[model samples]
Target: MQRRDFAAALTAALAAPAVLGATPAHADERSGGGLSRRMRAALAAELDDQDTARTVVPYLQDIGFDWHPETIAPERLDFIVAYGFGNRPPAGGGDPAKVLPEPGPVNEELADTVARIRRRRTVPVYAQWEIARFLESKYRMKNVTSIEPVIAPDGTITYLSTDGVAAQVAEARKHVPGGIGTAGVVGFRDHVKRCVQTTRDRGMTAYAPRGFEMPGTYDPESGQAWTRRRDLYVVHDMAAQWQVLRQKLIAQAYPNG
Candidate 1:
């Protein structure tokens, strides 16, 4: 191989795509289906069904699996999940399949209670309502809130943070600068700091930013929008930690069910 030839080859290789994030198309590069890997990377299910797709996306993301939806033959749906929880966090890792309430025998009284909730719920959608009720009933959920907001045409914004995770507000700020989700911001860390201060002025702490700068992705199963995720430093205190658990109890528990 002449030096000139090698240089050209190297340049060509550089031009080739860097195997995009850990999708099955690149799964062969590693081995094993452990929890640690799943929590850190999104994975494709082996032996999985298309029906499970309805629940698997959120279940996977709840435990930290960053994924892209894959459509395949139904019979190929059977898959295994590696528990993503670690020491001192929760025994089940970052998943509820290992820690959520089991559908043992619901009391006759509690059964009736669920039927009533099925009728008069106040959530944005049906699935969310059902899941919320289950967590509140079985898990003693408290201090739970949703931060979905709309910025009015006059440029005023509606603020929404319940757990005050601190990081979330930062992320939200990055998503739409000046609390505006319009077509004018570059989503940066500094912008997040202002969001926190603003939230504080309005009598609330804040949620930290985790995936503020990414685009939203679709999950084929549940048909919900999930944010393409990045990492952030989060506080491990009660207001934040327990709230995360409460969410898992409902959303992640039978996530793919």
Candidate 2:
């Protein structure tokens, strides 16, 4: 899918009733007790339905799980693509000297994975703008490429979306030996599936390493809290799956447009 088309489809998906209706209500319930018992029950039922749909639908099911290789095999891939999680620039923009923003938890995990892979064998790494700078300056990765952001004429910095990133990787792959090679996508466990799928949508082989997922802790003493957190995470991923499905449908409907 073209970047703008995919972005539009994703925006539509974000505004879809299934996402907007559920997410805000859940957030409100968590903050305070405004919802009545009947309303709460209805919301819970809606979430259950979403979960069931995600489980039964083949395409939705495919992008809802993590893919992990059994061991680190740098030889299997010509390069690595590590995705960042919530590395947006600071509001109002601060120091000019701080070009390399600090890595978030997800980027930290990705950097560690890249470091491990580099230790085994040297391979090129591609990353989003902020994390790319972090890897180059902090990790001192010799062969790092930054998937830069799109700056508008008005000076708005728009980070590359998942589809945009995949498109960039497809373009970069043309320069690789034999015009194609395997790519290992590094990111949060819940996010890895979508990353790999989008990369493959661009006609390149992509996989995720076993580790490097966002860490979750279970507390038996507060089991209800844990369940709520887990359900929230699942619902969020379901929304992302919906976005992916919408992008596919848009591409099919407007193949020439």
Candidate 3:
């Protein structure tokens, strides 16, 4: 999908009903209770510290969370809701030693997005995988399921989740042509590893997701190269995760895409 489309789709997914312990969309926005107040303070600090508000605001909105500049009156807001959905990072100091856990069960929205991409004749598997990784980073989510890809007899790929059968494949391709190359996997793994090290260097505790692995190129004596999955370190941090994503876009020359 195009970047705009991807962003919009993600926003819609975020706005979906409370999944993964997210606050419900219908909650009272003006409630200045302890949790809401703390969340508001945290959001205000983030908006003030980073120029990424423009990039993150739409994300917050899409996730069924509400936000505004602190200057706005509470009555003026639709609600003072906030969902820590994107990877913009918390502004106030948090335990740098805290490591987020793996995501659990796939919500309907996320499942639908994955299913849509997987069945599209043109969506690259690598890209689909990248999107999945992005979702994990965007929400810092844990306990989510995985999508499995099966190459068809026609050389087409069909994406399936553990929950059910594959949906109808798209008649046309929906994404740029590319598959996971050995080099791409290795490069991504290295990039993520470096980011993890960088976070640790800054005194933050971080780690690769448990059972994390990546596809790597393997050579046989027959002079053929095949891609294989290899275990890799994958630290999860909003800032560091976003850095990796930015690098991917730059590397692929899609800085504005």
Could you say which candidate leads in TM-score?
2
Off by over 4 Å in 2: 1-56, 63-72, 88-102, 210-233, 246-257
Q: Give each model a TM-score.
A: 0.18, 0.61, 0.20
Candidate structures ordered by TM-score, highest first:
2, 3, 1
Residue pairs with colliding backbones in model 2 are none
Model 2 C-alpha lDDT per residue in residues 88-147, reported as the tens digit of each score: 334456642333334444466567767776676577888876567667767887888888
User: Per-residue lDDT for 148 in model 3?
Assistant: 29
Q: For model 2, what is the error of residue 166's alpha carbon versus the real structure, in angstroms, after optimal superposition? A: 1.3
For candidate 3, the per-residue lDDT at 57 reads 41
Candidate 3 wrong stretches, greater than 4 Å: 1-23, 28-40, 54-58, 64-158, 161-257
Global lDDT of model 3:
0.30
Please report how far candidate 2 places residue 127 from its true position, in Å.
1.1
lDDT tens digits, residue span 1-257, model 1:
34555345434322332443354323323334333233222222331444454445344433222222222222221110000001122334444323322322212122233223323332111111223343457544443222233456764534323223233433544443334221111111222233333334333333322222312221122211121112222122222433555565777668875
